[model samples]
Target chain A: MKILDIYARLKRDMNYIEKELEKSIYSDYTIMRETSAHLLKAGGKRIRPVFVLLAGQFGNYQLDQIKHVAVPMELIHMASLVHDDVIDDADTRRGQLTVKSKWDNRIAMYTGDYIFAKALGVVTQLPNPWIHQIMSKAIMEMSIGEMEQIRFFFHTGQTIRNYLLRIKRKTALLIAISCQLGAIAANAPKSVSQKLFLFGYNVGMAFQIRDDVLDLCGTEQQIGKPPGSDIKQGNITLPMLLALQEESLREPLLQEIARIQAVDGQTDVSAFIRMIRGSNGIVKAEAMAARYIEKAIVALKDLPDLQAKKDLIRIAHFVGNRSY
Target chain B: MKILDIYARLKRDMNYIEKELEKSIYSDYTIMRETSAHLLKAGGKRIRPVFVLLAGQFGNYQLDQIKHVAVPMELIHMASLVHDDVIDDADTRRGQLTVKSKWDNRIAMYTGDYIFAKALGVVTQLPNPWIHQIMSKAIMEMSIGEMEQIRFFFHTGQTIRNYLLRIKRKTALLIAISCQLGAIAANAPKSVSQKLFLFGYNVGMAFQIRDDVLDLCGTEQQIGKPPGSDIKQGNITLPMLLALQEESLREPLLQEIARIQAVDGQTDVSAFIRMIRGSNGIVKAEAMAARYIEKAIVALKDLPDLQAKKDLIRIAHFVGNRSY
Candidate 1:
């Protein structure tokens, strides 16, 4: 059960999905084609597609059966980034200029819409009601998560429970469904698909907690985002939520966040980074993420015997335990 | 067939569809629910939903059959408006404040995504692939049309053909699909569905051309938008395109447009309105709209012997011949 083997297979499917995406996005309007191409070029890890492929392997695996969900799920991820960029007032993504940065905000927004429509068009080509239901529900959850983020912004009394829920919906929910839909598309037994979905969901939870950690502790060069950028943007992730819970640290922490808000993009972010890290919040956050990873591993016990299953287990470990 | 009777029927259907929309859009994220509720409050003519219902009558005419199309078609229309308002920097719609204006552009964008997700979710309740295919394609076309509009803004040498193509995709294509999808959902004969689709398509074309006319000549009291606002936004619609064709008027008209570009929300608006109305462009544009209305009437020749069909025919004439 080699992780490399799973990576290779997922990459192959991603290439096919990528080509389909390229062809489907073609339009007589040159700007749509151009802008979509630019956003696509800001490549993602294709993690959702990988989950789709890996989940399919637990059942009657077929590359063709899985590509429908794999492609559209990935496209959904891509579509949301354009809108997210506008919301975040982000200048760069994945070390490249964002869609809104390169073009005006309006064109970037419509480009997101154009990609979303293409995704829906592409997925409905597959003859399955359940697949559409799963994918569309994932989109709904992701949108709600986004709205929640906007609502919670600048709220100093952010609870750890609410933070976890927000992260699950915003970042993990779609990834979870990517796996579940793949299994369903491949005609896996409902139980097998459901187990895989649970595994995916738990891992997604752990993955986002780590992302919050990386935003606070990892160097800007490693992650392509400024350290403490989340707090600056008024997003209180799990780490910040945990840090805010300590009464001794509360007032200074809130004051620092206030200063971050008052400062422009070039504010001294490193001081806040050190404060969060040194307060023992990161350690507690890591332990919480580990619990989710363990839960994900337990969910995998129900899967049918396959090397793909083992690879997924390893990927979960890799996501939660990755140091750099 | 009485137009009032047709309006009554449409109003009933719209009320039910609006309820469905409300139920589908609500989420635990209360902000998403409330923002979408605000957006739905900006009442529209429900023209798309009406087409969906009328077109379904061409098939196995049933209230239930038409609703599946009508609800989603209207939701899709509303979703587009949410995003469009953001793109257009529009402050109002239907004499009410726009979503982007009431909430920031960020909320408007997410609210659009939320509605789009809900629309796609609702459509899957019907077990028909063709409905999804047609509706998805319509959405894709709408996005591309928006791109074309953005790209062509303020370009002086733009032709009438380019303008027509843009509006055809932006405005006409969705209405055409609403008709086709409604019929398809009801299991209407393909030929009848095709005829209704063509009828709707041509009428939509005339509807937009007449809209362009009103944008150039109608008073603010008659139309919510100020006259010549399209040109103010740098979109060279049919009236301006026709005016641009004359050798005597090209440079002076372009100078007027250049002045439009230099100003943000104000210009010598009254003089420009007077100039367009006084020119032969107004008459030529009206003639072009009339052609499409006649074509729409011809497209309805094959509709069934029903009161709904007769009402649709009258609505086409009303849409085309309405001077205000």
Candidate 2:
């Protein structure tokens, strides 16, 4: 099935999740309500919630039970994004002004905290202690991954293994747990939830790798922000790291990165973007992402063959191949 | 019991709590480890944990069970302080360089997130979902209170009711839950825990009021920061608001505040500090705090007259009358 087809299939349930998201972040404080509502309206693909809903299909498929997992997953994702914007000094996200830009960094910080707390509040309404454990661990890992990103900024000496670990913590773990928790919430067998976790984890890896590659290659309209924002913000992603390994591109790219760092990322990065695009980095990164997608599909092989399984496989492929 | 005697009574368990706090914040990353450890070392009174441990005595009083509540209370407090430093642009807290100052705002933000996640992880080990629910709600209220603080900064029109509400969320809620959760963790009677919550809530109110008054009237050595730091940062405390009501001081105080705002708080605030100190604001704020302490004592009137009850009352008095 196509990505749009899956979203359409889940449209009614997704609407519930969306409204629940809005309700979860509602605050009596005017500025908080405005800032959080601002973030809620600046929509994304809602892929995490989608993954949760699909994974729940493998179980008894109860929307009420699964939304407890789904909404918090999306809320956590939203909270991290707000905090990330503050760290990235980003003004725009998903083609809208960020909380930090629209209000201020302090507002963004507390808004993120408030949303995260709301997410916890929603999830804790579930009676399972295991779900709480997994969610909190994912949050801790994500935070460590965020700090690692800051530490690795402008440092080209980082290995591909470091990049993988960072992205695994920063993105993949939450996705993995979304599937795992969704299945568990709906009373899926432990074996099925474990397999779904592996599937989500591999897909999340591909998803992030594709995102990094798109940062270098996608247009302004396609990516929703300026291309090369990663490099401009000194984030050395997998593609950039892979590109640095090219002997012919290494010296010139290093010099360009050095220049950007010297000016504290004030310079235009179109030249740097062009150089990476012209290199083998794009193809190599795509190949790695395809490998992760393959593993994701393989993880689902042991599960009962259902339409949701096929949809998961299709979503994995879409994540691997999507240009935007 | 004297405060030192209370510490002596709980020394062994408090040591375990201290170690658990260290273990809770442990990270594989060097920077995460160092920043968190630094915060742990630059300790405050650990008053929240003390309340938790003391409140646990009214129940079955298992140190193992109560430490979970105690440690997380302190960790959440630590996490908020780290984030507050980022928002306040504060360099020193408790006579040590703030994480934001020593590293950067990005590091401080993630460090706070990491610590908060760890707190949740520790708390979820307990089987009771109610604890998680209460904890998460307190976190949400605290974040709202933090945002309200920013919203009310330098706004002289804010009433005493607004200030009370802000501090209730920011300070009292967590302390109240610390007592409530501690009792619940130890399997205390519902009525007992409810009363403990009320006791903690009032003491926390008085505790914050005393801290605010000391911020203006105390020396740098006494408060661990500068005397006029609150006014300098545009934090309009109760004493300041009360002082603003004075006919003799209103015009000059407003002018000084305006001048500080004009320069973005870069100028000397000693003149502002002296004016508020010499006014009747301190005496009136003290009276209000004393009322809270009285309420706190009244909360414990029906609890069995154990030594723990006396300790709780003495702690309430200490909070109300603390000079530093």
Candidate 3:
């Protein structure tokens, strides 16, 4: 089934989460309200919230109980996006002006901080110290991951292991906790929550790998931003890393990267994009993504035969195959 | 009862907190560790930790228990300072280069975020959900106050009430919670915690008012940064706002402010500083600070006569009178 079908199934609960997200970001200040609402309007797939809701289904599912987890999951994701746009010096995200671009970097920074603090505010209402602990640790790891990305920019010497670890912290850990926290909030069995965490973690890894692959391969319409944004920002993604390892492509690829770096990525990167697209790197990265999807599916094997389980398996496949 | 005397009394417990503060910011990432360590080394008065420790004395005071609240209070303050330096475009803070100046803005931003997350991580170790709720809400208010400061920058049309509300969120709420959470963590009586919160809030208001006054009146050697930094950065502090209300200084001060704004505050602000100092603004602001201190002392009237109460009262007086 398509992602839309899954959303359709959880439509009512998703609406509640959407409303909570709006409520959570509301501010008395006009500029803050406007900036935060602008980000909410330029929305994403809300994948984290989806994972949260689905994982909640594994326990005593209650929309009231689950939303506290779901809303913060999305809010944390939104907060990171605001900060990420600032760090990347990105003008637009998802085809709209970023918080930094529309307002200023300082405003964007505070907006992100506001949203993040608001997220903690929502989660703390749950009275579960474990959720607070897990969420805070995840946030810390994500910040470290962000710093690592900056440190590794244009440094093509990084290994695949380095990339995996960074992405795990950056993307997978939050998703993993979304599932775990959702389960924990819903009073799921510990063993079930562990399985869900593993499932979500693998799915998140594949999702990011697919995203990196799409940055080079997808059109602006497909990805919601310019193609090769990763290369433009000197973010050496999985495909590019794999491409650099190819004997035939290594020297020219390095030179192309050097050329991009020389201009501070101001010049056209279509040539570099074309070169990578023609190489075996895309296939290798796709294979890696597929492997992650398989692992995700394997993780869900011991889970109860619920509709949520079936939906998760399909979502994993879709994540691996999705172009956007 | 000097601030140093209070520190001397709490010296041993304070040292444990200092060590914990160091331990909390530790990261496996080299740059993260270095940047965080740099901020820690450029220490402030550690006033928040002092408040936490002093407030704990009214309870079942334990170094180990109170350290959790104390460390996070200081970390949150440090995180806000790092971000504040970015907003202020400040090269130095407290006679040392700021995080943004030493590294880049992006790194500084991440370092602030990382430190803020670590603060939450430390705080959540306490299973008291109320502590989390209060801390999270205070952080939210702090961010809002920060945004309001940005919104009101160079805005000469603002009122005294506007300034007071902004400072309340920016300074007082965190300090209030620092005391409240400390009392809570140590299982202080609710009445005692409430009293401490009031004491902290009023003192914090006085503290910020005094700080703003010092920004204009004190020397670079005394304040550890250049005098008139507030006007240079378009932060219309109490003295400037009070001076703006003066009939004689109004138009000329507006002109000078316009001149500073035109140059984006790059020009020397000594003339503006001299104008404010020569006006009644400084004395009026000092009087307002003294009033807040009186209220702070009054807040402790019903509290049990303990050394902590006397210390709190002394700290409030010092905050009002402090030159730096």
Candidate 4:
């Protein structure tokens, strides 16, 4: 019955996961060791690991077994991000120059590979098919999602269902797997694991939606990124699509969209931002996020009485309501 | 004392491996499957799987188990080539238009991912620690080699040792792992497997050196690539480094190097090819390939009396002496 704030607990767990990840990549190549260290130091929210740890608590929860799953899941996340920055041709990540922008695209790609190798190597230590099954499957889905995103970029007619499925593959599904893996590793009952998985899935969907909303509403300092960035990158997020629907605003929107698209895919972005803000896009997005929160909570209602489950529910609520 | 010509046997085995690879990727993504199949079909000697199958025969061999290792290893090789084409921005491969060239970079990247997924999925079926360990580490090395290659592009003063090391990771190590994994999967004694590893390692090193020679000496029709293409790509291959040592040849070499660099960084390349062909670079490179063939034979002296081992040695000699 230890009632600890989720972020604080996440901070504690991430410290160890961070340490283990750093230790794992130590090799004779001093340069590779140093480069990998720089990437780890770049830092991330460690949301995936947090999902894993929390989900483990829903079962018999052995920390030793859970670490194996947690580390690899996070590394996979890290590996994907390095490649992502390259594909996005991004300059800065977390207020620092990305591995790609700093060294080059190739180093970024290898750094990703090094991390993936280290992660997969760790999975071998776990004597089970369950973990490999979940992890490899997750990687496959994430890759397919990325490919679809790349293929469908700037295609305005893509349905919300398609968008949802893509995001599910790209973002939410991994988070869901993290929880499922943690629960299974701890030998948690199948029903408990399924419920935890349901909870993770619903929260993940809402989490990505909130991220899109932040890209529209949150300031550069607020979200650690410039607002309307996705639109600028020609990735039509939910709010931008909603704004696109108002045909009455078509001329001005079209002008702005054309201007953005005209910059050879490097539009100023703020014009669309201003438009989205003025429109009720933000409000509509938040309402949608609220609906997801309700769904996530309902998934948890049948779970065993535990403070950890309550904390998870609280985090989901906060994710929906968090301001810039 | 089985006097079967190893090269002819290898050619037959390679063809079998290629057909199996095509069958493995036959899925619903017809475009992707065909794109991958075309790359596999547009031939290169399937040296890797040949090494794996040959190595497997050293122990308790099973076609079923060995095929899992051999087919996936070849698929991974094919996948890397597909991605390498995009990363290298090369237009043609194996005398055919590259996927990136015929389609686009995004499709090419996805095709690589799809093939990579299929590769891992196939390898995981073996359910052995040794296979995963070898395959995953080989993949990591391949990625690191790629990173190094990208980083060093157009930087001409790198030591011969560094170039060799880079090529080892990029080429030799994967082939070495192919042999080692083959031996391990067949339940060969550790000592036998280690010898097979060394045998493959030396041959792979010589194999790459021969390729560098061919890149300088062979014509497009004979080698499936234009002569001096490596120089055209700003790659300081062994032959280029050897050619640069003569101070008298240095300026013209430097000028050709500069022209190649220009073509690589962005310019027309036909003129650069013209510059390199008009030089003494090719002959010196062939002598170095000859030296490596001798070194590769030295690695096999301790192995047991087996027909597979003898044929492997003969193939290495053939590869070393072959000319376009």
Candidate 5:
């Protein structure tokens, strides 16, 4: 099933979350208000909140009860995006000017911090200490993951182990928590919450692998920027790691990579993308991602067969297949 | 009593906090660990923790119970300072190379974020939902204050009211929370905590006013950095605002301010400093600071006649009179 079809199942709750997400980011500060509105306008798939609501459905499924958790989870993601743009030094995200590009780095940093504080402020509205603990740990891991990315930037010695650990911290953990927090907040059974966490974790892993793969294969129109923008930013992704392991593709790719690393100007990254795509790296990465998707599907089998379960299964499939 | 003498009263608790503060910043990531260590070695006065401890003393005064809350308060301060250095584009702080100078802005930003996350992670050990709420609001206000500072930078149209509001949010709010959180964490009565918050709020106002004053009158040795460092970074402080109001000093100072705003390089700020000091601006600012100290003393009157109250009074006096 398509992602939209999956989203269609929870349209009411999703729309409410979308509204709450917009309202939550409104600040009295003019720049903050404008920047946050700019981000909200440049919308995402609202996948995290969708996962949150879907997971909550397994329990009491009260929109009012789960929204405080869901909205802030997405806001946390939004805040990270603002900071990430500054780190990537990117000019556009989803065909819109990033906060850092439109303003300055200082403003971007403040905006990110402001949004993060807003997330914390909103989440604290709920009286659950465990939710705070979980969210705090996820945020901490994400920051550390960002730092690790910075440390490993343009470094050619990155192992697949390093890439996996970084992706888990930077990307997967937040998604997993979104599911776990939703379930726990709605008073889902511990067994159900644990399974949702596992399912979300596996889906998160696959989701990131698919994202990395698309960075190599997708077009600028499809991905909202150049296909190899990650490569341009010197982010060593899964396909790149796999490509480097191949003897035939390795040296020529390394030469191009070295040239790109050495210069300040935009080196043509399309050539590097082509070289990686030509290898078995793409196939191997896809197979790995598919395995993760399989694990996610397997984790869902033990849950009570609710309509939300079928939607979640479809969502997991869609994460593996999404182009953008 | 002098500030050091007040500090001497809590030397044992202060020492323990100092060590915990050090231990808390340590991370598995090498860059995070080293950068955090660099910040720790910069050696703040550790005044936030002292206030926290002193306030906690009014309650049950268990060193073990309050240490977690106290340590994170200082960590939040340290994290803001790191980010503030980037905002200020400052190379040196307290005669040492700032994190941005030692590494780069991206590293500095990440380090600040890492420290903030660590603060949250550390504080999550406490079960109090109210502490989380208080700390979250303090952090949110601090970010808004930073954005306001950014918004008002180099704009000479800023009023004393704006300056007061900014300083209260950016500086005083966290200090107030440090005291309030300490009392609350130790299970102090609501009345005692409210009074302590008021006391901290006034003292913090006085503390920041004194800091702004010292930025003008203190020697380089006393202030660590040069006087007018704030002006150099386009920060319009209380003394500068007062100096700008003087008819005799206005035109020349405006001309110099215009020149500084126009050029990117170092403009000689000594002339503006001299002009402000030569006027009654310093005197007026000091009087204002003194008024805040008086207010802080008044807030303490309702509290019990305890050693902590006396120490807090002395601390307020020291803030009003401090050279740096």
Candidate 6:
């Protein structure tokens, strides 16, 4: 199944989730409402919510029942993006101006806080402390992931383990929770929910690796920002990490990084991008992402085969193959 | 019934709370643990926790039962302060370097987020969904309050009602919840809990009003920073609001504000301070704070009179009279 086919199957539910996301972000304050709407309108793939709805389909598929989990999951993602933009000091995301660029960092911070509060406010209505426990842990991990990212910025000593762990907390955990919670909310069997979690976790890991690769390889139009922004911002992702392993490239890369960090202006990133692209780093990262996709598919094999399960397989492959 | 006497009575419980607070902030990550410990060491009066304990006394007070609520309340307060410093671009708070100043805004934002997550993580361990409900609502109100404050900055058209509402969310709502949640956690009577909430609400209002007044009249030694920092940062407090009512002072104050807003330097605030101090604004603001304290005392009149109740009355009066 193609990504389009899976999306087609989930279109009605996705529309409902979209509306619920919009409804959940309503604030009495105008700037908050506008800031939140601005980010929401920028549009994401809704991958987390999509995973949530798909996982819920394994048992007791009810859009209304799972939306409380789904909408907030997406809203949490949106809230993080707003704050992430503030941290990145990026002017645009997905080709639109960020909240920080449009207004200011203070406005962006408050908007993020407000959206997070609304997410919490809506989630607590579930009447289940277990769900709260899961979400609180996800949020905690996500915050830790952000801290790790900030501390690791421009640091040369980072390893593959560091990269995996950071992305695990920043991306994989939330996606895993989105799937697991949806299954749990639908009263799916415990084993099934656990399997869904692993499946989503592996898929999420692959998803982020792919995103990091695209950050280097994809163009401005494709990735929605300038190519090589991660390196420009001193974010050492998988592609850069792989490139650093080459003995010939290491010294030059280190020199380039030092020069880039020393200056405030736009230092040319094209030379580094050209060097990395010429190396086998992209191939190695892609292979690793493919391995994660395989693991994700393997995890879902134990669950009873259904259309949703098929779509989960398709999503894993799509994540592995997605260009941007 | 002095502040020191109240501290004497609550000292044992406060120590336990202090330990629990330290334990709750422990993280596997070094920066998180260090950043959080830095803020925790730069202690406030632990007023919110004290309120929680004092209000818990009205019911079947168990230190273990209420300590969970009390510690997280303080942690949430700490998290907000960290983020607030980033927003204010403040170099120091409470006589110590702020988290932002110590590290950077990125670290400060992450530390605040990590602390907030820890607070939420601790709170979710409580099984009662109602407690989650109350805490969630308080968090929502606090977030909205922060947004209102951001929007209201440098806003000349704000009213007394706007000022009151802003402080209600920023300060009083959390205090009120600290009291109300304490009563609820101890399984207090509903009417008693309601009364405690009102008492806390009024006390918090008066507390913030007095704090705003002190911001104008206090010396650098008293406020732990220079006087008029609020107006310096575009925060128009109660005294300034009242001073704006005087027809003659209004134009000069507006001109000073515009000038302060324009150039970024150490503008002499002494002239405006002298003018406001010479006016009736301080006296009027004090009267308003006194009324709130009176209402706070009145809220508890029908409850079973006990030492805790009397201590609460003393706290309200202390808040009304506190110079810092």
Instruction: Name the top TM-score candidate.
Output: 2
lDDT of 6 by residue, B131-177 (tens): 77788778777877887887887787899999999999999999999
Instruction: Tell me how candidate 1 scores on lDDT.
Output: 0.82
Q: Which stretches of candidate 4 lie over 4 Å from their true place?
A: A1-4, A10-12, A250-255, B1-20, B23-31, B258-284, B302-307
lDDT of 4 by residue, A212-239 (tens): 9988888778777667767777777677
Candidate 1 lDDT by residue in tens digits, B59-143: 6867765677788898888999889888888897667888788878888888899789878888877888788888888888888
Cα lDDT tens digits, model 3, A1-324, are 488999999898888889889999998888889998999999888999999999999999988888888999999899999999988888998889999999998899999998888888788788777888889889989988998888889999999999999999999999999989989999999999999999999999998999999999999999888898898888899999999999999999999999999988898999999999999999999999999999999999989999999999989989989987
lDDT of 2 by residue, B1-324 (tens): 378887888899888989988888888889999998899889888988999988999999998888888998999999999999999999999789999999999999999998888888888788788888899989989998998898888888999999999999999999999988989999999999999999999999999999999998998998989888888788899999999999999999999998987887888899898899899999999999999999999999999998888888888888887976
Model 6 spans with C-alpha error above 4 angstroms:
none
Ranking by lDDT: 2, 3, 6, 5, 1, 4
Off by over 4 Å in 3: none
By DockQ, is 1 or 5 better? Answer: 1
What is the DockQ for all candidates, taken in turn?
0.75, 0.84, 0.78, 0.48, 0.65, 0.65
Each model's Cα RMSD? 2.0, 1.1, 1.3, 3.3, 1.7, 1.6
lDDT of 3 by residue, B11-110 (tens): 9988889899989998888999999889889988899999999999889998888888999999999999999988888899989999899988888988
lDDT of 3 at A273: 96
lDDT of each: 0.82, 0.91, 0.91, 0.75, 0.86, 0.87
Give the TM-score of chain A, superposed on the true chain A, for all candidates in the order listed.
0.95, 0.98, 0.99, 0.93, 0.97, 0.97
Q: Could you list the chain B TM-scores for each candidate?
A: 0.95, 0.98, 0.98, 0.90, 0.97, 0.97
- CAPRI classification of candidate 1: medium
| Deviation from native of the Cα of residue B159 in model 6, angstroms | 1.4
Candidate achieving higher DockQ, 3 or 6: 3
lDDT of 1 at A263: 69
Query: Candidate 5 on A1-324: residue-level lDDT in tens?
Result: 467777776788788898998888787878888998999998988888988998998899888989989999998899899988887888999988999999888888988888887787788777777888788878878888888887778878989999999999899998898999999889999899889999999999999999999989988888898788877878889999999999988899888888888874278887888899999889999999999999999998999999889888888888888887
Error of 1 at A88 (Å): 1.7
lDDT of 6 at A226: 89
